[model samples]
Target: MVVLPMKEGDFIKIEYDAFVKETDQLMDTTHEEVAKEHDLYNERATYGPMSVVVGSGTLIKGLEEALKDAEVGKEIEVEIPPKDAFGDRDPKLIEVFPMNRILSLPEFRKGDQYPAEGMEIRINNRTGVISRIFAGRVRVDFNNRWAGRTLVYKFKVTELIEDRDDRMRALISSVYPHSEEFSFEFGDEDAVDIILPDIVKLDTNWAMAKFKLISDLRKYMDLRTIRLIEVYMKREEEEEHDHGSEHSHEHDDKAPAEKGSEGEKKGEEPSENKEASTDGEEKADEKKE
Candidate 1:
């Protein structure tokens, strides 16, 4: 069995732990047990091997480059400088504002106390953490929390996803983890159809996920068309009622009119055929590229 090295556009599952080189502080990991051991576990996060397309620009520069030519099931450790990880911190990113200005914000105006040091805040579309609170002044640092720190990563490519359907499923599950039961089918003329689960329709993140899924499909797959099918079937009771009505209407003179109306009703099928090509996502693809 020959294990080929990963290359651009390869879909693979990876597990990694990232740490700050200076303090050896664990910044992130794919393993749940490691996160628990470090007391960095998040109740909302799903921890496990993550799916990624190599050279898709989803990973930090150093990490993505390291995975390129790496074989599956081989653990590799690499040290990444600030330049390739998060970039060096810039002093210009630190700004000091009048303490009164911070206190006057809408959040604090409602009786909230002065923000304590290390508290993160978002203002004017920029997010920063409170670094200092001096006499009548508040200093905020907008640089990334890990800026200027060299990072160390221990990672391994666990599995290579080769099947087209499995690759699509993996990509979808990576973005929307709850979509394990979703169905994918190849259609005529280089098109793929994805039948979304009913639960996804109720998700508030569905809109964003739909667009992201479309973008990723276009980027990674060679499909000319991507369709998201949302099926809203009639309830069993409703179907039974309609069936009874149709049976009675068959014996009536108005049956022809009723059948015509039913034909019109069934025309709603077009509404369920949501094609990515028709949506404005092609423009988004251009912008993303």
Candidate 2:
């Protein structure tokens, strides 16, 4: 079989481990075991091969350039300079603020005495980390964490996504890591229907993820129309719970009436229970519907 060269717009899956050359610190990795060994495990992160569209600029300049010359299933190691990786640290990016000013920020208003060193904070819509705190002053460094450091990446391109549907799925997964839970149906006229999982609708970042997915799909796939369908169906357990709750209230309401009827049968005066039996019935019916 002839192997085609990877080019721009080609979708591929890659697994990599990146490190800072100076300290040999593992900056990032796609392998869970490697991250754990390096004490960089993040429970919230998804560990596995990551999908990428070549030359998309989603990756750093150096890595993207290196991927162009990479072969699928062959592990390659490359050293990237500060210029090609996160750019060299700039002295101008460092700023010192008065301790009072730092304390007055909204994030620090929770009765904290002062910003701790290494604490990340946002000011003027820019994120920075506190590098130092001294007498009446706090230094915030806005440089990228890995700035001025040489990066080493050991990576392999696992698979090239050539099928149209598979390409679409990879693109979607790039935006939302949980794309496996979504359903896709391609139609004529370059239109595709994406049936979103119910869980995604509740995510705070779902809107932003959707916007990026649409932008990528249009830019890469050249699709004309995209439809995101969200289906909300009541589960049988939920329906049963609602019905059970309504019946429970109804039973409670009848108990008092039944007791009153029994008292009357014994020729005793009926107790005056002023509470309305239909009070919660309307609310329960509304909830069920």
Query: How does each model score on TM-score?
Result: 0.72, 0.77
RMSD of 1: 23.8
Tens-place lDDT per residue, model 2, 1-289, is: 2143678898998999999999999999999999999999999898999988987776789998888677888888999999999999999999999988888899779985558999999987899999999999999999998999999999988988889988988898888877889999989757999999988988989989999999898889988899999898999999999999999999999999999888777653222232343656777889999
Each prediction's RMSD over C-alphas, in Å, is 23.8, 14.1
Residue 108, candidate 2: Cα error in Å is: 4.5
Q: Which tens-of-lDDT digit does each residue in 141-221 have in candidate 1?
A: 999999999999999889888888778877887578775779988987479988889888788888897888888888888
Candidate with best TM-score: 2
Q: lDDT (CA) for every model shown?
A: 0.86, 0.88
Q: Give me the runs in candidate 1 sitting further than 4 Å from their true place.
A: 100-114, 174-177, 197-209, 231-289
